[model samples]
Target: MNVTQFIVDTYGAGTPLVSTAKRYRPSSTATKKGYILIFAHGTGFHKEHWEPIIERLYAHGGPVVEAWAIDAQTHGAAATLNRDAIDEPGFTYSSYHFAEACANLCKTHLNGTRHPIVLVGHSAGAASAALVPSFYGQSRTPPFSALILVEPAIWPGSMIGMADSLAYKLACVAIPRRRTTWRSRDAVRKDLGRRAPWGTWDKRILDLYVEHGFEEDKEGVSLRCNPVHETQPFINQINAVYPVAELDKLRKKVPVHLVYGERNDLFTREKQESLLRGRRFASVIRIPGAGHLVVQEAPDAVGDVLLSILGGLENQRYVEREYVL
Candidate 1:
């Protein structure tokens, strides 16, 4: 796959700029009917984390033209770019910022594209993905033809009390207190390899995180995304619940699919059901031996599921055309 890196200056007066990478097979023969995929990563993760699954998607030979991944202003390469602004005291980042970046990419870089655009996001990234369409306003047509939310972290307004949940505590307390600086990449890799979540991650994803999720300096290497910045979205909780309502609105316009790991660690059964209440989805799938971090834990399974979803969409389009004829 050929890769290209670029930055998109988000719209609005004070929105932070976001970094993006595009990947495509050099020999791809896909035309307008092929899908153009846009991806958003979870909090504390970088865009490169999705590369493994993307590689699998390419190998599956789905109707894919190209794939694009965005780094939230306070995560990955974007975090390095916005260090000054984000370092400011009281600076807070929200899912809205990520959503604005996705909306900006579609309005600018992908403007007037003919291919069907599919937006895929995992965990907190799914919140941002769900809110992307709202940024276009009611006057404009949303760029996405479909959405695939992998273990979406979105919750209804009724679940505002989730701040007291264990997941919230882990995000706000444990993450900030976790080790950040390491003596060397080898040391970091060893430490993470023995940890709970990291140890559970696919080796390829773990390798990607080690490569792209940190930066080297005089004091050794540290996480590219400051732990404080990573906890901001969890602390703010302002935009977290908004995605639920947005999903309700968007489902009528585009097919919205949900993918869950068989294990329900972060989001409990009741919490997951909250997202389904009074809303219709195109499909719901579950992958065994994975949790909320399904993208990192089971990339191959994710790729297989995505290919099936894409094939279904293609068939649906064909049937619709035939009906029109």
Candidate 2:
């Protein structure tokens, strides 16, 4: 699929609160009936990761939805709010900050037309989307009309207060020590193919990840999102509250769709019911044989799910589709 790459300024030149995005829009006639879909990737990933899924969605028969995938602050080409401290170690990565930045970008750039805005986010971005509703409360017209969260970063209620736990502390330490450079992009791909999450990713998606996730350096290739920035959300609990209330607030006003991979270890069936059971406009589904990174594992399947959801939204039916894994 063809795309336009651009940067949206959030806080002017001095601040590092800019966002980089990839956008795809169908021909004018086909786009008249669709909502604007904004995709926000997880921590450490670039907007390019959303391309495969976008391609699959367009390939399948459906309403021609316009889509944009954004690289969050501290990731991809987006500049940091504090340019002077780009290499700082103790910086915090708050989901609230990401949500506000996303809202700013949508309001400033994507809201030019009359289409309803739908925010789709994965992992950390999913959590950020969850927070967006709270930030935009009921007083004013919400910038986004719907939300599609994939394996969000929300932990179980029991673990909400365990931000200082040993496992999280260990992740805080281990994540920062991750390798940031490689001899080349091919070398990075080969190395990541041998790693756990990356090993599970589809080759094309992984290639796209490397293509946008890294930048050439004097020595070799280094991660655009530094380890410090990528690891902040894991260790910092300053913004790690449960999002049940936030989701509740969003469900009342707009459709809230939750998609989880069946093999995902993060979300349990009980948790799904607890969060989405009988809400006025909420639904949940599981993708068979998939995991937390379902977008990378099965872009076509993810795309099919998204198209189905979009169809439902357009028809005001909230229809459900079945995937065979």
Candidate 3:
């Protein structure tokens, strides 16, 4: 394995934002008694967006830990990842599959010998974290030490009515609707979310997207996450190859924390309840007056809650498991 650092460009944060990672050494010995935090970036956002959040976790977390954040496939520097094979003959990539692959990657490449990780994903990433582990393999991981799902956009799984589904279906239409490829970044922005209400992001964040979402197309300028890369993924997700029922299938032992912004239009109160379905085992939080971008909206509140969870986890003592080493 090549142990080095490199950057991959993505549709959202390609040139402007950077997703950088570094490992924290636990100790010389002791089986590396530390936790691992694997982050899943949000839609139209990359890992760099979580830099402030991750810094808060590092600063406040107890028992010491290591963390890494991945740019969601096709969204960040990992944009080129599987680019050539978006709609490959043998490849079937769903959101669930994407999450599983990320977990596998974390297990394989992350510099730690630790079990019982602290898995956290934001927006679409949160949905994946809340749902993927249970389906990975029988008894492989105990549904992560704690799953933190933050303000997932397309949430409340069952509240998915026909109208919303239809809207998503229309978005999928972008797959075959290659009428005129955008030649400039301006064209792409004009088309984003139908240009209605623009995006409810911090103005600076929205500007950053404009800066990164477009490139110098040979014809003029074209968007990187074009029809094929995006529309196909949209198609794949709606028709998910493997649907996760709930967290139970993953493992009941692992706890889950579902966090959302109170004022978030994406994961509204009703939408979150629908997704969670009032599950008893998991924890739920509604950040007061926050929006879809909770971390950026209320960094202090988010950090406080996360640190509280980690603090509780740090105090728990695990019993010996039967194993042959």
* Index of the highest-lDDT prediction: 1
lDDT scores of the candidates, listed in order: 0.82, 0.72, 0.53
Q: Distance from true position, residue 129, model 3, in Å?
A: 2.1
Candidate RMSDs in Å, in order, are 3.3, 5.6, 7.0
Clash-forming residue pairs, model 1: none
**TM-score of candidate 2 relative to the true fold:** 0.85
Question: What are the per-residue Cα lDDT tens digits for candidate 1 across 1-325?
Answer: 7788878887442645656655555356654457888999999998998898888888778788788898988889888888888788877667888888887777767776667788999988999999988877576556677999998888777776553557666767788787889988888899999988899999999999999899998888889999897776667666678798788878998899999999878777677877888788999999998988899999999999999999999888822111000
Ten contiguous residues with the weakest lDDT in model 3: 9-18
Residue-wise lDDT of candidate 2 within 1-325, one digit each (tens)? 5578767655422345567777786543454556777888888887788887887777775665578888777887763433344555455557777776676667667545666778899988888878766655468545566799987776546555443444446667888999989989999998999997789898888998788788888879988888888886676543445566677666777778888899735344454454444565466878999977788888778888999898888787422222111
lDDT of 3 by residue, 26-56 (tens): 3322234556666776555555555455556
Off by over 4 Å in 3: 1-34, 61-64, 87-92, 140-143, 153-158, 162-223, 227-246, 317-325
lDDT of 1: 0.82
lDDT of 1 at 145: 78
Measure candidate 2: CA RMSD: 5.6
Q: Which 10 consecutive positions of candidate 1 have the poorest summed lDDT?
A: 316-325
**Which ranges in model 2 have alpha carbons more than 4 Å from their true place?**
12-16, 27-29, 79-85, 134-137, 155-158, 161-173, 266-281, 317-325
